[model samples]
Target: MNLVPGSEGGFAALHAWAIATAAVVAAGCALVGTLLVVRRMSLLGDAISHAVLPGIVLAVLAGGRPGGFAVLGGAVVAAVVTVLLVQALRSEGGVAEDAGTGVVFTTLFAVGVVLASALARRIDLDPSCVLYGVLEFVPFDTVAVAGLEVPRAFLTGVVVLGLVGAGLAATWKDQVFAAFDAEAARAVGVPVAAVTTGLLAATALVTVASFEAVGAILVVAMLVVPAAAAELLVRRLAWMAVVAVVLGVAAACLGYMAAYRLDTSAAGMIAVVLGLEYAVAAIVAPEDGVLARGAARARLAWRVRCEDLLARLWRADEARAGPPAATGPGDWAAAAWLRVSGRIVRDGDRWGLTAPGRAEAETVVRSHRLWEAWLGRHVELPLDHLHPPAEWIEHHLGADVRRRIEAEVGGEESDPHGRAIPRERGRPNA
Candidate 1:
């Protein structure tokens, strides 16, 4: 392909070809990976990737070139055999799925390595290339397509990607159903077995397509990492697939550039980049990410502290008592924040609620007492137990919910504790 251009071009052309090839391979892996992740069959994908090495070696020994149709066919057969073995072990031998996967893949991979070593003199395949890959050398192996020389690896990746994408599109609904609930999907006539077999075949195709770029070992990261990251970022399957492909492509480009600059392995760099993407997704995911959930907890805690302080002040005012003690650091901080926010004000040496704060405090007390009354009527809790539940529930009840509780408790004037339930903010008391 002459990717390196001297008077014609430069190494820029080679770098571009390499990066593009990596991106294509990554995209295909991500597509298949999305389904594997969703179906919890990621280990199966890993198994297929390793187990297919023997097939590739055998195909090469049989005069099939790497990244060619013959190699791909052998790889798919190997993948199917791997899956059948796993199923047989689970059903007949009562071996666990994970154990079966481990046993089958490792054993097959060992056999492949032995074959590759023994036949190294006869085959064009390199043991190092099987483990790591020869992406740098991919540009040198070109075939003419439509009168234009293109890298063989890239062409195979594109063809496999298109086929996998088309097949999935035609049966996305069935795949989704089977992934989530295979038994139910089968009951509904969704052809669960066929769908699963198709996925295994697709996994094999993508694995082999990636074999020249990332190799058999690192291809597991290409297949699983981006899809796992996408699952964290998105809720829907279609969006997850789209996000996974985008992430995988971006990682491929960045990783290739990084490897070029650092003078390291492109496959290793690509796996590193995918790990970084997953880490970023885990930290920043919307609902369940560490940062998001932490922030939510902080916000709720702050609100609860503020409302608790307000309700305490209202209770003191009702009892004609002095200001509540701000004994703890949290209490003092909440008090200072409430005063600065205009919810509390300085009155002589004590703190008092502002007009708006009084209204808010009244609502809180109303919620608390109404809940206590409702629990008293509905539950057989002791009067002492009523206060603790109401105390916690006070912060969560909205005006509408409080009003409903109020009505359901017969518009109680007093709680089970014999304390008067404050009226709604705008209601007049006779």
Candidate 2:
């Protein structure tokens, strides 16, 4: 079996193998990336992805097959060297971590570019191979597996994914502890340093495995984007890892199909798709997404506006005066909603609370005046300042809290302003 453009069956197999390879490698990257992002070592992953190129080229030159265990070992060694060089610069030379990282990775990556270009014929690597991978050509390179011809890139991706997944699972608790509190974890004998070394090694392995399929830069995108999006969608580390792997694989499959349809770079399309997934996650995430937060704010504002309207009407009723005119946008909206709910009625250019509304209004006024009394008793603020705090807090007080505050305020009938404090409905005054 030959994989050539002229054969329809070969082209179909090529597409399937390419997508499968991308998905498996993306999963590996996502798993390692979850830890890296949580530990705030995402920059380290990016550096390793680019910096391993010279080591890989050297290993291949030394007769180690590309995507083999020897190549993986070389990559891990290169990644460790990159981290050590960065740390040395930071500790010994008094350089900042970010600055040291910038210097080390860029220098090493540049050296790799030169080596790969200089020995292009020997290593079969070109300039494009350094940045954009040869994913579309993956099926052309095959190895026999159990009487079946399998694409070597896909096999490499599966092996790396399994190794990374198993390593992370076996050390998940330590990883979580170190991610959140490295100093405390180390003090408690969690082997944070070994865990960190293993993580870096895993990053290097995943990066090298995906190198032939998605290149250096796009692999970084695969490593960071899905994990970041998953973090936004979940709070637990285990759940986050699962979601990240799913998102990464979905992005890989969708991106490959899109690239095939559009006749574009598959690696580039995969990165773009990952970006889109992150944007969507940011907008619609479960608890703290932009839309969810906005809706929560709106609901709180609505409750405050309506409660203020009711309290104002109650005060007017007490004074035996007409309701205050609704002038502001907030007042008008609250007024319309109250009238619709039968909490208020239009009486010839004025408003008045119904019987049920009056009871609820009394509760609001009680909470407000009780808070004002408490503030006046404990806080040294002037009368005017007390009103501001009570006005802001009145809507949040519940019956139990109000009862507690009423007792704490020593059953004061009048606030510091000398206004009559409304009693809680159905409760006898002391």
What pairs collide in candidate 2? none
Model 1 clash tally? 2
How far in Å is the alpha carbon of 346 misplaced in model 2? 4.0
**lDDT (Cα, 0-100) at 63 in candidate 1:** 94
| TM-score computed on alpha carbons, candidate 2 | 0.93
**Candidate 2 C-alpha lDDT tens digits along 73-186:** 888899999999999998899999988999999999999899888887887666786788988888888899999899888898999999999999999999999999999999
| Model 2 alpha-carbon miss at residue 101, Å | 1.0
Per-model TM against the reference: 0.93, 0.93
Over 4 Å off in model 2, which ranges? 1-7, 347-349, 425-430
